[model samples]
Target: MAKMRDRRVAPSSERRKNPFAAATATRADKTGDSASDRKLVTSFVLLCIVVIPAVSVLLYYVKNAPRASHTISLAHQRGLIKTDVTYQEILTVISENASQLHRHYTYPVLAYITPWNSKGYEMAKRFNTKFTHLSPVWYDLKSQGTSLVLEGRHNADMGWISELRMTGESLVLPRVVLEAFPRELLRNKKLRDKAIDLILTECKEMEYDGIVLESWSRWAAYGILHDPDMRKMALEFIKQLGYALHSVTSVRNNKQHLQLVYVIGPPYSEKLQVHDFGPQDLQSVGDAVDGFSLMTYDFSGPNNPGPNAPLQWIRLTLQLLLGSPSSRVQSVGWKIFVGINFYGNDFILSEGEGEGRAITGREYLNLLEKHRPEFQWEKNSGEHFFLYSDDNHAKHAVFYPSLMSVSMRLEEARSWGTGISIWEIGQGLDYFFDLL
Candidate 1:
C-alpha cells in the first residue's frame, strides 16, 4: 500500500518538474497561435479583394445614377409617380421661384403723382406704401429777367405729403419743362447760378428729398444735338446743379444728402439726325447725377400709332444705354430707372385722320367694358388691342399695354438690375396695383 501511494505522488511531482514536457506544451501553443494569425490575415486579404471591389462598383453606380431614374425611384417609393408634368405643376414651380426671388431681391420703385388731378392724389395716397419715392408734379421753373422763377402753384391742401411721410416715402419735386424757355438762358452763367441757388433754397425750405430734372425738352434736346455750345452749356448746368444739390443736406434728415435724377428720352442710334435725346447728353448727365430716368415710353403717342414701347426696341435701348464698343452711349457711372407707360394709344381706322389719341389705362379698360369687342394680343410687340366700330360707323383700333405686358417689361427691368418708374400713378388700371 505504501509503495502504491509513493508511485502516484512520484508521477505528480515528475510531471510538475518535467522540462521536456513543458517545452513540448509551449511549442504546441506557439503552433496554434501561428495558425490563428495566418487565418486572420487570409480573412483580411479576402475581405480587401472581394468587399473593396463590390463597394467601389456600388459607389460608382450611385454617383453616376441618372437623375430621372433617381427621381422616378423616389416617386415610386412614395407612390406619387406620374406620366407627365402638368401645366399647374409648372406654374407651381414658377410661383415658388418667384416667391423666393421676391424674398431675396429688393430695389427702389419711384412713382410720379400729379397734384392737379384729384384722382392722382387719391391714387398716391392709396399706393404710398408701394412706392419708395413719390415725385409730385407741382413745380416748374422759368427764366424771369436775369433770375429763375417758380411758375407752378402749390396745392393748399397738400395732404399727400403727410400721407407719404407716414409711410416713410420720400417727396421729390418734379421740375417740368420751362415753356417758351430760351436756350440762351442756359448759356448765361449768372442765370444758371441763380437757378441752382433758387432750386437748392426751395428744396431746403420745403425739406424736399431731391428733384427730378425733366430737362429733356424736344427743342433743348435738338439744340444739344445740333449746337456744340448748347451741349456744353447743358453739361455745365447739370454739373453745377448736381454739385450744388449734393452739397446740401435735407432738413428732414440731417444725415441725408440730396439726390439728383435726370430724365432723358429713350436712347437712339448715334447716326440718326434729330434723335430723341443725344447719347452724349446722357453720358455727361449720368456722370453728374445719381441716376437717369430713361423715358422709354412715348415711342408711340399722338403722333405715332404703334406699341408704346416695343420690347425689342426697349432691349436695344437698354443695350445702348449700358454701352457697347461702337455705341455713342458710353459708361458714365449711374443707376438707371426705366419708365413704364401707364397709358395707351387709340387710332381711328377711318381715313387715318386723328389717328393717335392718348388714353389712360383706366380709359382703355372702360372702352373694352363698353364695347365688349374681340381683343387680340400682338405677340411680337407684347401689346393688347381690339378693333371696333363706333356708333358713328367709324372704325377704331386701340393698342395698349395690359398687366401682362407691364409684367414682361418689369421682368426685363429686373433682369437689367434697374429700378422701375411708372409714367403716372392715377392713370393705371385698378388691377395694375396687384402687379406691384
Candidate 2:
C-alpha cells in the first residue's frame, strides 16, 4: 500500500518539478487573448474616427448653398440709357392727344416701385416726379436721404425715371442711386476728379432737372449673397454715380428732378419660381433709380403652358409692394409705372412646345370666353381679372374682362389716388385701355 501511494505521489512530484512547462503554457494563452482583444478595440476606434469627420464635413457644405438661383447678365456693367429714339417718337405721338389719352395723377421716378410707374406715363408734365420708397434695412440699402449723405464725400448719383437709352457703346446715365455700402473712394483723388469731370459735362448737356443723388447701386442685391469683390465693385460704381449726381446738383438750374427721383426696383424677371422670396435679384435696382418700373405683366413665357399673369399673383404682388409704398399713394408715379406684358417672353418654344406667342388681355379674354364658357373670369380691380373654375382639374381660362371689369380695375387704381401707365403705345394698348 505504501509503495502504490509513493508511485502516484512520484508522478505528481515530477509534474510540480516541471514548473517551466506549466508557466509557458499559461503565458501563451494569455498573450493570444490579449492580442485578439486589442485588435477588436482598435478597429472600433478607427471606424469612429473616420465616420464622424466624414459626416460632419458633408453636413457643412450642404447647408451653405444658394437658394434663389441667380441669373447672370449677358452684358457688362454700364450706365443708364439716355433715350430710345424709336420709343420716344412713338410716345410723343401718343401723348399729343392728351384728352383722348386719359390722363391721371402720376409718379414718374419710382426708385423701388417701377411696376407702378414705367408704363406709358400719362402725366402731362414733361418733367418726371416720383414718390419716395425706402430700401430694405436688412439688406443694407439706404433710403434716398441716407444715400445722399453717404456719397456726399464721394461723387456718385442715381438715375431712374430720368431715362434709359442705348448711347453709343455705353449707357449714358444722369446719375446712379442706391443703398449704402462700406467702401472708400477718397483715396483715389485722380479717379474721383475724372468722374466729376465726366458728370459735370453730362449734366450740362442734359441741361436741366434737380439732381437725384444716391451713393450705392445694385451691390445691395449681390451683397445679400456675399461676394466681397463684386460688392466692392458695385459699391464703387455707385460712388461714381453719386459723383455724377453731386456735380449735377452743384450746377443744375432745374428743381423738378430732385423733388422726385422715381426709383425703379423689382422682382428679378429672369428668376425661376420659388417657394418663398429669395436671392433678391432686383436688390439694388432701386438704389440708383429715380423711380420703380417693374415688368409686372409678363405672363407670356417661352415655357408657359397656360394662361398669362394670373390675377391672384398680380394682386398679391401689388400688395407685397404695398409694404414699401401705399398702392394708393404710389399712383402719383403711375406715369413712372411698371410694365405690362404686351409681347411674349420669347418667339420660340422653351422646351419645344407652342410658337410662344403672347395674347393681349382682350384677346386672351375673348379666346377664353369663346372656348371655355364654363370657365369664367370677372374683373377684380384696375385692369385686373381673375379666373373662375368649379371643375377639379385646377384648369384656368383667360376671360375677357367686361366693361365692368375694366371699370373696376380703373377704380381700384384710382383708389390709390395715383397715375396709371400703359406698357407700350403699340401692341394692343387700346385693347386694355379701351376698357379703361
Question: Candidate 2: lDDT over CA atoms?
Answer: 0.30
Model 2: per-residue lDDT, tens digit, 321-429? 4423422433332333443333222122122343334343334434344433332222221222222222342223232223333333334344333333333322233
Per-candidate local distance difference test: 0.55, 0.30
lDDT of 1 by residue, 213-245 (tens): 776554443445357667566677778898788
**How many clashes (backbone N, Cα, C below 3 Å) per candidate?**
0, 69
Q: Give me the runs in candidate 2 sitting further than 4 Å from their true place.
A: 1-102, 105-200, 206-243, 246-253, 257-265, 268-289, 306-308, 322-336, 342-354, 358-422, 430-436
Q: After superposition on all CA atoms, what RMSD does each candidate show versus the true structure?
A: 34.7, 30.4
- When summed lDDT is taken over every stretch of 10 residues in candidate 2, the lowest stretch is 20-29
